[model samples]
Target chain A: MSGLKNGILVAALLALGACTGNPWDDAAGVGGPGAAGLGAGSALDPQSPAYFQQEVGDRVLFAVDQSSLSEAAKSTLVGQARWLTANPDFIVTIQGHADEQGTREYNLALGARRANAAREFLISQGIAGSRLKVVSFGKERPVEICSNEACYAQNRRAVTVLAGGLTG
Target chain B: MRTYLASLAIGAALVGAAFMATAQTAAAQDGPLRIEITDGVIEPLPYAVPDFVAETPAAAELAREMSRVIAADLSGTGLFREIPASAQIAKINNFDAPISFPDWKAINAQALITGGLSVNGNRVTVRFRGYDVFAERELGTGLQFSGTTDGWRRMAHKVADVIYSRITGESGYFDSRVVFVSESGPKNDRRKRLAIMDYDGANVQYLTNSAAIVLAPRFSPTGDRVLYTSYESGVPQIYVLDVGSVQRRVLSTDEGIMSFAPRFAPDGRTVVYSQAQGGNTDIYTLNIETGQRQRLTSAPSIETAPSFSPDGRQIVFESDRSGAPQLYVMAATGGEARRISFGSGRYGTPVWSPRGDLVAFTKQNKGRFHIGVMRLDGSEERLLTASFLDEGPTWSPNGRVIMFTRETRGENGRALLYSVDISGRNLKPVRTPDGASDPAWSPLQK
Candidate 1:
């Protein structure tokens, strides 16, 4: 146990300790769904107390309403897959986001599909399926705000956030 | 929130009785004599509403303001016009005074509207009457409306609606309610809750607490109930609320799915909504009365924004079945889904017209969003608005107009409610107390 009295714990150490308990608890957050979810846990876990502290790698962007990864996006993702492969004890989350042109729910689904597409591509690139996760903010998180195509292009992106550090 | 409404800035003064002071001075300001009955099409009744016949000097201004508000309320709708209080050759003395119908007819006035208001302890009662000079019979019986000292303006609009309905044979659109999401805080962390207000955007009443984010609030066919989606339980879920008592209950919480975008079926016993599960969403129907749910769609493609036809036989929804979001229709029983949207980059949030004639939806073509309506078969697509974001079109009870939320794109985002007639003649913003979205116009309350 790393309960060394006066040592300051890095976020990776904290996340790794939290992850040792359960993955669902890591995802579900405090008062979120337990392992037996749906009804056993509360309907909403607004704040994830057990928030992930995965190291962020390279980012990926897509075209408007298009989740297809560009060459640059693919190359950056290659770098991400390499980093994830080196950190064998870590699990990663892929968050997909879209610009604000589409409806809220549709954007959410688009984000989900985009995240999944990214995760699948990573799995194809040698990352273990269980080591990867995905979430979609839909149009909720717009990195750009202009009405033109440029802003939307920047917003339609898949971000890889890593968590749970490997230990000896 | 109604209690909070008790504190908003009260608008215009209640109308006072018109008193016949002098015919000579009043006759000098006659506006115009425009009255006609051509081809069996009855035009708005022309009236010479001389400032109310004020009996006391203090009552003179209240009388004038009341008459002006009345004329503005009527003629502002492009319906009626003032024949000038001066046009009345024979002055009608007072509201309850004996009057000869011939005197008003002599000036070619088709209708006469007069009101008298009495101020009591912190309250006012407006007594208004409408008469059809052409038919020589009272159009709407004399109506008495009581309001707080500040609610005189609403009482006045209510009076105008009574006259409009009594003469036009159509239910009054005024006096109805609009329920929407009130936004506060920064754009990134918006806190939204359900709010109800008068159709004119007066007397905003917050219905739900801001403990959670609420979205897509749809009014029940009856004004007393509201159907909306809440994020209270982490997952977005639908809830039905009693507008009067503010009592609420979760409508559908099936397993791990998220239910949102709810609208009542015509029967009011059931609601159609989109349930998201496993990264996919499909339409589902919930019998709120019996706690039963029937899945209407089984496609892995995203199927959402389901709206039932007026008769509940067919459904119009937005689906990504065509590789992009497009409009589609199928039997309410879920069979033979036909693609209805052809000219579009992406379309979502389709609401069937209450008249059973058309479906309104949000379309994103060439990266710009537009609010458009098409026939049930997706034949005639007419885009009503083009903007950064214009979604969630809710129709007036008459089906003549559709109102939707419009959010202007910028670092500082602002969402407002706007309405456009199906004819596209009247495109106006519905005034709201704060930033508003997901406005559902309630059916005209009886």
Candidate 2:
């Protein structure tokens, strides 16, 4: 489960946490978006690094810095609701995010707003409110890597991720 | 009076047109090139750092060589003019005795750097004292170093850093190291590896091999390690590199997620970065020793590029949460966030200055990119440079100048390094062998 040197790791952590003992700080410097959808060749499969069963067409997207549902976003939520309604027992977490063009904390707040925006839209579409959860990445995951306006325009979005499943 | 005023107006218009014409020529093919601090007093300060004169035979030469390098580094920035040893009016007679301020002032040196070195086998101990010329008292007492003799250059830089801090009331950058992606070969197939260099760009050493694509390598305050994003496994992953032994380890392994733009927590233990999951991205932190992952943010918007304030209490990052990419600040522990950028165009690479008063960043307006700085509240925004693209600003330890990447068209499409003072004066090339980007200044060596 681990690779690379052990001493530097210990030293760096000691230096970082020497002042304040914040356990949650472990998640500080992670940025980048890889190919997201579950793939047959993914290491997360039971035969892979870590994998779980995923239903078809399971992800959602958002507009630039907006968590509010547009007509198009509402339509996307309706499609998501149909999937949830058909399954009747799926649990999901909505992760909100901002792009690389704004500040970090505001993006976190904005990411929260966007995730709520999508969650509200899905609930209105008839998905049980409790069956859906929300989280915000705030410009952490970027499908596109460049820093230009074109790339940032696409990175500001909210997504719906399937978590636990309820057996009938 | 009317006729005279017309001639004065005409003369001023001609000068302005000439400058505009040059800018237009640069614009016709590429983008913007302008310097805001057009006029200033640029009289470089003169000081002397004669051979440190180690007390022992083996340490003697090193002391001399190190002092010379320190002198050169200080003068290289064009902020200082070093007095040659040939012009020395008096020798450093004693390391423990009080400095003869009158002797130094007689030579008209506004400042002075005098030190002694004691070589103890493999280890070298250096001690230097700084003087305040007019005050006639010691500005610095014990500026010292105890390190491997082999790293004599770094030791020298450390000495220069101490001298800089004592005189300027600001931290010295000379003692710090620069973490950047070193490049070679053609632009299309250029091979780049994460490398570490002394602040003055000496003793360039590669930290990561070319087997991966490394972007934005940032240094920890201690200067012993680096945090950078690499494409070694064909996806962006945050990795920590140890400077002493040249080893790296992956920090993030969220399946189907790409993690990039890694910056160390001011404390140097954890890191704050962005992770892309599915099609969404958010900022997260990783503890180096313990594989503890805490999700500080949970928004579905794209959040990347997180820089921590010097105190480690807050973080500044770029986001499009406001409908456009702008700078924002939040508590480092994660909480309510506020907007700080209100200029124009897109802004990225917000680097908090070591002085903690300003954040240096890249601002793009009207198709032209600029390197500018603003207060923590996003006020008093000053544009330092304008060019085809001026991004990734790194502050000098003193926060006096900003070093960033500049790219021109044609043969120079590749990025070259340029430097400018915070006042916007003294725009000049940093003299890299080829070109450079992501310039991180080191803390003054104490």
What tens-digit string does per-residue lDDT give for candidate 2 at B319-438?
A: 776666788899987777788998778787798988799999988787677899999999999999997667788888668878887865332246667888887877887766656766
| Cα lDDT of model 2 by residue, A69-158, tens digit | 667556656766777776665577676667654433345556666777777777878788788766555543443334555545545665
Cα deviation at A162, candidate 2, in Å, is 28
Write model 1 residue lDDT over B396-443, tens digit each, in one string: 776766889899887578889998766554577888878889888888
TM-score of 2: 0.62
TM-score of candidate 2's chain B against its reference?
0.79
Best candidate (score: lDDT) = 1
List per-candidate RMSD values in Å: 12.0, 15.4
Candidate 2 Cα errors over 4 Å, as ranges: A1-168, B1-43, B54-63, B85-107, B116-127, B133-138, B142-148, B294-301, B333-336, B397-401, B426-428, B431-434, B442-446
Ten-residue region with minimum lDDT total, candidate 1 chain A: A24-33
Looking at model 2, give its docking quality level.
Answer: incorrect
lDDT (10s digit) by residue, model 1, range A1-168: 122310222222234333223333222211111322334434333222222212222357778667677786676677667766766777776777788878976876777667777887888899998887666667755545456675566568776665566222
Q: DockQ for the candidate 1 complex?
A: 0.22
For model 2, report DockQ: 0.03
